[model samples]
Target chain A: METTTMIGQLPEVTYAGVIIKAIIILAVISAVAGFGTYVERKVLAFMQRRLGPMHVGPFGLLQIAADGIKLFTKEDIVPQHANRFIFMVAPVITAATAFIALAGVPVFPDFVIPQEVPLLGGIFVPSIASDVNVGILIVIGMMAAGLYGPLLAGMAQANKWGIIGAARTAIQFLSYEVVTGLSILAPIMIVGSLSFVEFNNYQGEHEVWLVFYQPVAFVLFLIAGFAETNRTPFDLLEHEAEIISGYATEYSGMRWGMFFIGEYANMITISVIASMVFLGGYNDLWIFPAALMIVLKIAFFFFLMLWVRASWPHIRPDQLMWLCWKVLMPIGVINMLITGIAVMLVLE
Target chain B: MENFLAQITTIEGFAFYLFSALTIVLFWITVMSKNVLYAMTALASGMVLISGFFFILGADFLGVVQLIVYVGAVMALYSFAMMFFDATRNIKENNTNSAIVFVLGGLSALALVLIFAAPIHNESIQALYPMHEGVGNAQDVGIILFTKYLIPFEVAAVMLLVAMIAGIILAGKKMDNSLTESMDEDVEDEIMKRKDLK
Candidate 1:
């Protein structure tokens, strides 16, 4: 968070530092995304009273590596009637947007590479890759733009199921985006800044996590975040039972793997956002370092997503839209209104 | 070559030229492509690249809003509408009179250039809300929108609300009909009508 030190502000950030940070984010998040699949399977298996992926390696820890090999080595296929260009590009869009959204998110606290570290020595890497003022908006915008990936993928595949999936992607994503924005609006209103660091610092200053003040917003954001990431219970986009993997019906090999990585990456992004905005971010807590605290908070949210997935049943597409527009969106708007009134009263 | 390369490679200059080139190419594709999906995609990307200009101007809030409203929401809705039609099919343009089109197009272009240039030529143009130095971009935008431009902003919002209501009303016609069933019947009737016309 402190971009400068007592030694007269050492250049703010170097290009090498930024580039190194980008590589770390991409590499670490991608690896974590792959590892997340393994974790999800293991968690779901334990919940269902079955051994999942035991044969791959010790308790299936190595399954992620095995799956990576399979995905990479498998033959890529394009449907005969598919739009080759868009079909090929769609998965990349999903992955790219997901990663780009993370650019605005502060994944870890800023750190300096020691002088002993050869090429990148003595460079200070900021927590956020591009520390824009409109960090929240960029994350939301990028995620919203990610809808094109599934929409195009389904449409370009020329399959009826894929088209239906694409339609669901449009409506589901569009509707949920409003709720996500509105839900976060309360916190933004209270903090009076769009930057994530500002939100974190606001909570630290107040000595209260925003979730305590804006519980409704926290709940609303969690729900909308679930829908945005296309997780279970709201994953009507590719609800395999209904539309046979929806937009991904025609996808195979690494292309499909890219979608999986994107989905998991988005899951992590949403979790990081929730943790930072509501759970005091990487702020130090009793007996825990700042970094550890943030990590634990993110892990808890990730597990919560998996736990809910294992427990809940998928809702109907109609019910999903009804819940979004009728229920969640209204609650979000009301929460924002109340927060606005409270802020006004306090100011007065 | 060294001087040119140095000028071109300054991050800001390089980014400006890159985004401009991409935006132009995308807009060109949007206009010329026969496939509706390609056109829609190009148009959306062009809108996104246009937002880069806002970022270049230090209007980070405005840039993100452009990304969200134009590229994220509006273009997405366009694509959603495309689902109802045969989007992959080539659209035939009736270029029956090229001379009239060229004349009209050139006139409009010239008019737009003049309208844009007029503001620059007149030194009387001043910032209605001169942005304060240390204020964040979002705060600056909010201050301007709520104070200086509140009336116009509200009017624009009302106009959008009206358009949205109208869209819902039009789309909600025959809302009780099952889309798949109706689409089948509609397709059959359409083919028959086309056959009759032919």
Candidate 2:
């Protein structure tokens, strides 16, 4: 069950660190995602020069815990006219897909689900849960694949507001997904492979974070990241101004909270992605006390999301689409084309 | 036999079946579905799912290209075309022409059963070169395509370029044959006049 115990059992299997590692990752991310909510609220409050979570047990650590308890106990109301089956499955699917990504995310270089110990061969073959070399692509790809949920959820709800929310979400997500992808091209171009493990090593040697190479891309990604998360300036899909309440407006209790939690969880995942792609994930040199590099890197972006939330006001839906499609997309195309050329030149 | 069977029923196998079934089912429904809009959606799903199958088969480049080219580009083109045409609920039909649909369906089902039931002979397994040390088949596949098939690749590029140009021209404002001919003639005349000026 523990790391050392498994290590003890298979001395011959040098790469036997895989199985129990999955458990640790699962536990760590869930706790992080749950606690991340409390961290964001507390950090945001403090940043606004306000006290936060002082009343809760020990600096508001129990704040997120209490919210979880509340959701669990709250009476779930299935909308009278809503498609019951899909409505139930929608939130569950959203939560599960968000969790599904942590499986392939490499916390440490060598940590993975255990390898097949072919006793004859003593090669310490390193691997993740699923090492397709296109591990990062699969994560992004699967993330895009789950967009059907919101779209279906909207239509299935059979409510006018739900349809508006769903349509806005679908358009918002797909358009920004393009920018999210193009922003990544610069990193992939530099790294010369799609493997995340290799990407980590690539950043380690690049002497600077990816933002240094691609500043425009970093900004572009930040905006697109906001769009993808359905946050402010890009959060017009759930707009209170124009649309009546917006998608999942009818959803009550935990069902609604699943979407709420899922959205925030996505923000964290995007932060993790940005960290991985640009901010040198787990690679804070000197500025951070050596022990807390990963923690600091994650925490910085978690704060960055809050900063954007507090600092920026929401944009109109038309403007949101225009910014992504017009301003970001062309720059993204050029970034990709330029990166591709650079990679080819370097390879040659 | 057991190993092959195991491989066929695993996640990889299920994906193969799932995507293959997706391609066929949606495609069949696209043909048979009463609603034209619904049929179009099905066709798009079929193409996308087929590309997904390509992905599961480790045809990564092909799969992504399939999605980008077919589902993304071609389907968009299809829907744009569909939008221009009138397809309302009035077009919905039960136009089966008696029991032929049933007979054909039964025949297809029987064919599928026979196909899966067919036995395999591993005649080439003993001769299969063992997984050995080298750049592997990916490199070989690449090398052969680029080197040996370089001429075809270049030719294909040229053809694709021509097709793309033609697509742009045709997808623009609709023109009669006479208008298209006159435009071509006018362009030729301009080219000649420019040559004279030079």
Candidate 3:
């Protein structure tokens, strides 16, 4: 798994190196992101005090595989009246956008799985394929890109309800994206660099995790995270009764699976990001190993999201907007200011 | 010998060919697909291909931004709209002006190719700098935005605020009530004048 350290020097292969690195990254993230669906369901089942996927191999570990097969084997139906192009490609966009965003993130130090392998562990390498300096901006940009899938899917269906749902999702995404950007200001200010590595290094020196210093920001982040992911309380994108699965209503079989996988994969990405910024990231916690700490933190946040799903009913679409704009927006801005001030005071 | 292979990177050319085809085919599919939804999806793939081109051009941030903003925001916006309207009617005209749109789109693509062709002549420079570091890097971008581009950035924020207000109003629905409330006082004044006439 940690084969990265085995390679030495910057990955200065031929002109082809860039293409190879990108392809590999895309493949790996897609697999992991696809697997994230398995994790979500298993966790949700456990929280509900029910046996999850006992029927599927070994506590439902193969559940996602089973689901994939089912989707692939199923019919790939396109509505007769539907525009063939957008409908088919919408899922591809949704899935690709979700996974591409993962490329900017470093899953662990020296070993974002593909970037660098820590030489000490015989697994670290310094080369991270390519680092987009504006990793955060890229990520935010992708968030917006990923939204297109749902909108296109719903609209392509040509159903009135589908169109309404798509419209709702777009509006929902626009409102939440602001808070998402604003919440990140704290971490950005502290690091003074948009490079993910610098941000990670800032955390390394602090050792105290941004969550401790900026609890408000953390809370705001979670709120924004919920909206950003379009999850419970903010999942008006697919609020069944009102608009059905929103954009996903018209989609069935494998076409639907792209969106299904993309959503959970993004959840994992967001959870990992939450851990990276607010938790110590991959840093060691107490006596545990760095990997273990990261796992625990990610699990805690991921479960928390599911837990909220179970505990809280979804909010109405209108309330969701109000929360992002009137409430979360102000809080995000204030948090940005407070974090900026704190960083200034400390650095000064 | 190695250098020649390195130039096309067999892998590089192959992936580029594959993705480019995927993009074109998908772009056609997006427009021609009777399901408007399929068209949006195809459009997303087309944009993803555009990002691939950005990648090939060595514009890392631009590529990523293409993925993030276009796929994430713009495509997402496109998808949401598709959802709003049944996109099953593929044969009919969707855009305000199809002829102009095609002409402009073609022109832009041609312009881009011409602009980039000049830079490709310097092979060594191209090899060294896949992406223009100063332009795309966040740190550099931040300084420029905060300094020379600060006003624009602020203005953009102001504009976004206006957009947000508009979104709330439109999405919130029941605009008639607000409209009535705003016009109520004026209506009352007219009513009083009418009463005098009576």
Listed in order, the DockQ scores are: 0.43, 0.07, 0.40
* Per-prediction CA RMSD (Å): 4.4, 10.9, 7.4
Model 3 chain B lDDT-worst window of ten: B126-135
Output the better candidate (1/2) by TM-score: 1
- Per-residue alpha-carbon lDDT of model 3 for A1-348, expressed as tens digits? 011222245333332443445566667666766676676677777888877677778877887788888888998888776666667887886787777667666654443234343432222233344455666766667766777777677666666666777788788877777778788877777766666656666787777887887687778878888887888978888888787677777788888888876786677778877887788777766789887887788779878887898788889776886788789899888888877777779888
Docking category of candidate 2: incorrect
Deviating ranges (above 4 Å) for candidate 2: A1-22, A47-54, A108-127, A282-291, A344-348, B1-98, B102-198
Candidate 1 error regions (>4 Å): A1-11, B1-7, B117-128, B164-198
Clashing pairs in 1: none
Tell the DockQ for candidate 3.
0.40
lDDT tens digits, residue span A170-214, model 1: 999999999999999999999998988888888877878989998
Predicted structure with the largest DockQ when compared to the true one: 1
Better of 2 and 3 by DockQ: 3
lDDT (10s digit) by residue, model 2, range A192-266:
666665666667777678888888788888888888777776787778877765777777778777777667667
Best by lDDT: 1
